[model samples]
Target: MAVIDLSKLPFPDNDLEKFLDSVCETHELDFAAYAGMNPVTQTVHGFVNYPQEWQTHYVNQNYVNRDPTLLLAKRSIAPVDWQRLRQEPSFDMVFSDAHDFGISDQGLTIPVRGPFGDIGLFSVTRKCSAHDWALLKAKILGDLQQAAVHLHDHVIQSEALSSVLGPPALSAREIEILQWTAAGKSQQDTADILSISHRTIEVHLRSAREKLGALTTAQAIGRAISRGLIYPA
Candidate 1:
């Protein structure tokens, strides 16, 4: 495994670009990025070192809705290797276009979750033989996950979530419930895990939604993640 010095990370919370640059240089990666979105509002934000042409192509093509990485990211909490993603045949053009712009199929995406329903995907990509890619991924996967978490946390602390709602204020129980639910646990499943009754769980979730200014439990989860109040388990 590569030796990572966490103390040397960028300080004052605004040097995220420097941090990503350092990682790409140190790891000899082709591209590295940290991207976040507010699921409730579908607002997207990204810190990326990808080729500008690729970015423009993605935007102009309106690929966000069709991007397979995003589709998996929305539902997944675990880190995803690009090779393992299941994409529809129609999305082949997206990958083909990316490759044409020098973006590789060999990549990894780490999903980041926050309290008010803010989700982030930190990704690193490189072009290499399959064997080399696997070896590199195995060696750096842990470090990448750590970096993603740190980057997400820094972004959350530095940025203002919304102009009107501000940061959400959720209770401990509410956060706990939301976290479990974000992990795909049903209300009954969460209630059983927490040793609480189903009705009680529902009550807390309802209150959480109101506190977060969300209209439903799912929206509440999204809002909570956006506020960094509850991370997906």
Candidate 2:
């Protein structure tokens, strides 16, 4: 069976172009982009509607060091409204600089945790009425925010895992169950939280253990965490 295509909204195509177009159309936002920071490389990766020259200018000038969005994004554990960040002292320069690039006063950002300790961001950019942007932001709150970070982070994770760990055999649900198990949840507890049967929970765990080359669920959970297949609950 195919993985449930809950990846993004049921859009017309999987292409990022179509995906972002749908985002703009559906959300009534001006633009969307994913920004990734590689601390190791000291580089910022961004996908946006702006010109390449703009991106290059930011990069060449080493604006990452002073970018308000990047700074706010670094500390945020979840999506943040742009206005919430304008108060931070050093970001004033960034606020002034954003106008040069046409970043709107109103925006939303989804912070993503990438593989190998990288921090990534996905933002909806726009120059619009604050009230309209607020409404749009409210429409996508909780759901779209999680989806954005989840999809973006998972893309990077899948690529990194594909190269370093071959491929994971378990599905997302299986990974979820295994993660809960690692956190000391019982089969019954897992089933309750997952809304599945205890037997089903056991089945998922057993399958995960087999794929992870562990003789027991405990070993499987430990191995999964060590391998970055799971994280702290």
Candidate 3:
């Protein structure tokens, strides 16, 4: 499958809707949705490829506050399967209404942690049997995770959001180190290539992490890429 190049997207609502449609087509999913929280404003922004009525109904009812899928997924580091939430009361409260719209209960939500405490939830659903759902999920799990990050980064960096949350200012050396790390180079390897000591590389990485508000080097690299400081390698 061709990799979805979300960086090329313009981030308009229509474009995001089209992007979700394409994702659904590619993955054979019935629907796809992306919700992102702006940490500074504590406002929720998102788009979905579900039926228009369902979207309106979700908003009218203010289901975002009571939806177990969103609530449970927010607390989880891993993807939250809808199967696990079937027993929850909130699940019934939200999904019971969803059923009226022809939405499926079998789905998965991938949680993406961004710099600046932003969180993105990317969900995809399909109407399929248990065995088929398992096989399909196992096959596309990695791609879904990548899509989640790609969409989240683009959304958070878009013009609509840039004013509230500006990209971090990273130094040239810090960017260089992050670029190398994104390319899968180890600290010692980066040091060797840059003609610096490993300890110096570690310092630069630590500084980069601090600047990017990342808890770890991996997250720093992700944020750097999202901010256009580096490219995927």
Candidate 4:
């Protein structure tokens, strides 16, 4: 389905819930969710259709810190298959508790990176034979990747910070400078190419990083590309 359909929904929360429901029905899965954590505030937001009891228990127990799936989200940008995660003794409790709560042992999590240093995970869970799930994941992986991107975009737009403080927009020159940097140009090189002084290049690059809320030039470049604010040369 086109992600634009989400915009037609009456409310952001309603849109996400309906999307999760559609995913469950379309894939014959037991549950679906889109979850994210704020990097600075350490707050979690969930658009999930799981049992309220399970959700409550998870938070009450601070399961997010120990959840193997969410822990993997920190280091991976690819889709994760629950079966493929390392089966360590320490992580066993997470999976065991999930199964007891009716969450399937077989699931997929698509890690999504947003421009503003936020990460989102789009997950689908189902109880199925290992063979059946492998085939299902093969079929839906590509579609879910695209869906994850759109879902994260919608979430970012609906965030309270976006409605209030908003993300800073880089100027054209700032974007151009970062694009050149991403293309492997040094500050001096980009300055020469753009007929500007090295100090001016440094200023623009710093401004771009600050605007993007990035700690480094490389991070600023990455943020710009992720947000479609700039393209690689």
Maximum-TM-score candidate: 3
- Candidate 4 stretches with Cα past 4 Å from truth are 1-14, 163-233
Clashing pairs in 3: none
Model 1 alpha-carbon drift over 4 Å, by segment: 1-13, 162-233
Q: How close is candidate 4 to the true structure, as a TM-score?
A: 0.63
User: What is candidate 3's lDDT per residue for 24-58, written digit by digit as tens?
Assistant: 99899999998887767777776788888998898
Alpha-carbon lDDT, every model = 0.74, 0.67, 0.82, 0.75
Most lDDT-accurate candidate? 3
Q: What is the per-residue lDDT of model 1 for residues 8-119, given as tens digits with 9 covering 90 to 100?
A: 4445634677788888887778889777776655656667778778877877787776777766765788888877774665348678888798788778889978776778
lDDT sort, best first: 3, 4, 1, 2
Q: Estimate the lDDT of model 3.
A: 0.82
Report the Cα lDDT for residue 4, model 4.
22
Candidates 1 and 4, the one with greater TM-score: 4
Provide the RMSD of all predictions against the true structure, rounded to 1 decimal.
Answer: 12.0, 10.9, 8.2, 10.8
Task: Give the count of colliding residue pairs in each prediction.
Answer: 19, 0, 0, 0
